[model samples]
Structures are given as structure tokens and as C-alpha cells.
Target: MKTAKIHLILSCLFIFSILSCNQKKEQKIETTSISQPEMVLDLLDLQANNKLGKDTLVTIVNDPVYHKAKKYKAVSASLLVKTEIELNKIDSKNTKIVFECVDGYKPEMPLELFLNANPFLAFEDVDAPKGSKWEPILKEGNEMNAEPFYIVYPSISEKDSRYKWPYNLVKIYLEPLNKSTLELYPLKNKKLETGYTLFKNQCLTCHSINGIGGTMGPELNYPKSVTEYWKENELVNYIVNPASFRNKVKMPTLGITKQQSQEIVDYLKYMSENKKKI
Candidate 1:
């Protein structure tokens, strides 16, 4: 009876030791996951170091910038991201991928959505003249090209506004998805959410209010709100079609209706009163 008790106790102790080690390993993994840092990729730095991975041929039909079907020497952006970032280490649903451009154009999309789609990073334009890597695109008589990098998706339609196609790309940032929403959301005036939503979806990428958005265009708030100087009616009209107000206008003719423009204007007026010195 004594010998039998010893054998059973020894087996129990062995099983307990295994369970304890497993529990410790799980705890360590959880800690590592919780402590993972934000992922930011410097595309130029990666290119200079030859760490951008393999380059492949990608064709973008109806290229939005070029406004024509074009081909490019590119790399798989999603794969590059996967290789550079440990997706398992981050909560993708709660995270976002922000594309920072040379002109300070920052556009972001949900990390989960970006990963699920076939996004490519185009490094060179295949159709450029033999001596040149990219052809100069004339916009507002300003010459530009998708040099260095341009994000494209072969499968996605150009009309899809949910996705952002940023050219002159420089950096990629992995941040909290709600980062902008938290900063720009109007908590005091819930009724003005429609206008706020319009501004967030359409205008925030190019313009900023109180310095919380892209600096590609002039700041709408802070030192003096655009609402303070420009007449409200004219401002609404200009928002709909900037070319109507000025020549060689850098702002594109966004297809926003007059009513939508007014809503955005209203939201800006609201923000004018709530300006934070940024």
C-alpha cells in the first residue's frame, strides 16, 4: 500500500510540473504580445538598405492619379507589411495603417481592411520613357510623378473612396484606428455629426482643422478659421468646386453636393469656436 501511494503521488507531481510550465509559457507570450511597439516603416530607408523584399510586376487598370491604365515595377505591399510586422502580435481590428507622403498627405485605413486586400507598392513606372523611371504628370500645370513609391491595388476599383491611393509616399505607420476619431470627433455637438462625418471622410485627408489632420492644404482653424474671413456662402461654393474661385487651383473638384459642402462648412464653423492651438 505504501509503495502504491508513492507511485501515484510521483505521477501527480509530474503532471503538476508539466501544467505549471505550460501556464508560465502562456503568461510570457501574453506579456510579449501586450508590450509590442507601434510599427512604422520608412520606405526610403528600407529601399536604401535593400530590405524592401522582392519586386514584382503589377498592372493598375484605370490608375487614379494617371487616369489611365498603367503598369509598374512593384512589390507586394501586403506581403512586405506581413514580413516586417508580426500580425499575430498586434490587434489588427483596432489598428490602422497611415500612409505618409512627401507633401504631408496622410491618409489612413483600417489595418484589417488593408491586409485583406491585395495592396502593392509600386517602385517604378514600366511605361516611362527608356531614360526616365517615371513620366511627369501635369496637375494644375504642376509636374509630378509616382516616383519613389505609390500604393496601388489591381483588384480594387478607382471609384472606391474607402481606400486611399497616396503617391509620393514616404512612410507607413501602424497606429490605433481611433487615433484621428478621438482627436477630431465633436463630443459637444452630436447633432453636427453628419457635417463632421462629411469633413472627416472627404476633407480631413488634405486639410486640417486645429492642426489635427494632413497639412497638404492650409489649416482651417487656429490662428484664424477659414470661416472668419471667407463669406460662408462663398466658402461652401469653393468647397464644392475650388477652381470656380481661383485659377490653377491645387484642390481637385470633389463631387460633393452643395448641401454636403454646407454641412462641412457648418462643421468647420463649429470647430472654429472650439479651436485648440495646435
Candidate 2:
């Protein structure tokens, strides 16, 4: 009788232990379920201000905070903005812009935070000029605002040697032609053909007018087809620093000084005028 009673006691203890273990497991699962909702909400909040979806998964992984939380460095992250546009192409009509984040970061942060509190909608009035030149209706009026604009997050990598932290942000503005502008070009009144020779010597190697030069870069004969988006100054700036516009571009600096660049521009203008005749 004592042996049977001891067996019953053992069975009861075993059942009790199993029940206790199951209860603990249920409690743990419930806690995890409750916390998961909060985590989802946090992720959604992080993605709120992303209008153009520029951020990437790689960017988030490289973040110091994320590395510390996950207890290890991330291998890679997905790129958010696959397509990129030149800075000059961004204007009032198409103000919403997306820049590919650095190689290993993710798009979990709000765009406003990434862009330093500048909204995309604010670009319309920020880059435009104040006064009208040659009547707003007759000429293409100032449509963009004058405020300095920048990429929300530019792509950066450890291998990059050119730009340091906080890449140089490009600013654009409009200026009207005045007496000073007219006076700067005294040679224009004297010899019209001087510009053409300079172009043939300097730019004829890579660039072609009406399908002439090597097919390395885009054809310059049709500036409208190449890019009607960029302003005059923007074009000049690109000619000055091709590296600033593209990452690791093959185009060399060409050592063309400012005066030479202007001469080339004049030659291009002459060519453009002649293109209408062709």
C-alpha cells in the first residue's frame, strides 16, 4: 500500500512540473507578442517622412546605434533609391527628390531628419528670383526658389577619397543680364570667329557637334535632347567640375580655366544658332 501511495505522489509531482513549465512558456510568448506591436509602430514612425524613399537598408546597418543594438556589424543593406538625377534637374515643378544613401545604411529614419529639416515643397519659392527680366510672360519666368538645396542623403563609402564628411552642397540662383554683363564680353563685339577655333582645338577630342567626335559621352549638338533641365550656370559648373556631378566619372578635369570655359560656351551658343539652319 505504501509503494502505491509513493507512486501516486511521484505522478502528481511530475504532472505539476509539466504544467508549470507550460505556463512559463505561455507567459514568455505573450510578452513577446505584446512587444512586437510596439516594435512595428516604431518602424512605421521611422518611415513616415520619406517622400522619395531615398534611404537604404545598408545605411541603417552601418549606423552606430543599430550596430550596438544588434550586437554585431551588418553584412549589407538594400538600396532604397535606385535612380539618381543631376542636382540641376531638381526644380520647383519636380521638387521631390531622392538620393541614394551611403552604401550600408537603411531607410528607417525620417527624411526630414535626414535632410536637416528642409521640406521638398519649400523648394518652389526658395530658388526663384525676385524681379522680372524682359517681362515674365515673354521669357521663361523664374519658377524655382533661391534657397540653397541639397541631397537628403548622398551615397558615400569608405573607399571614397574625394569628399569628406558633409559633402559640398551645391547652391543655384538666377541673375538678370545688365550693363555689367554686357560689358564683360567686349571681345564679342570684335571677333565672332575666335570662339569657334578655341572649341575645335580644346573640345573636339571627346565632344562632337552633329556626330563628329569619339562616342565617349553624350552628343552636344542637341543640348535640348541632352538635358533641357539644367540652367546656364549649372552647365558651366558641370564643365568646371565633372567630378562634382558624377561619382568617379571618367571625364578628366581637362585643365580648362574659367575664361576658356566661357569661350567654349560662346562657341556652343554659335553652334546652337547654326543648328536651326541645319
Q: Which candidate has the top score in TM-score? A: 1
Q: Model 1 TM-score?
A: 0.83
Instruction: Residues 168-189, candidate 2: write the lDDT tens digits.
Output: 1121111121211232232444
User: In candidate 2, how many Å is residue 157 off?
Assistant: 39
The residue pairs found clashing in candidate 1 are none
* Candidate 2: segments with Cα more than 4 A from true spot: 1-192, 223-229, 276-278
Evaluate all candidate structures by whole-model CA lDDT and list the values in order: 0.88, 0.37
What is the lDDT, from 0 to 100, of the residue 189 in candidate 2?
Answer: 44
Tell how far residue 127 is off in model 2, in angstroms: 57
- RMSD in Å for model 2: 22.6
Worst 10 residues of 2 by lDDT: 68-77
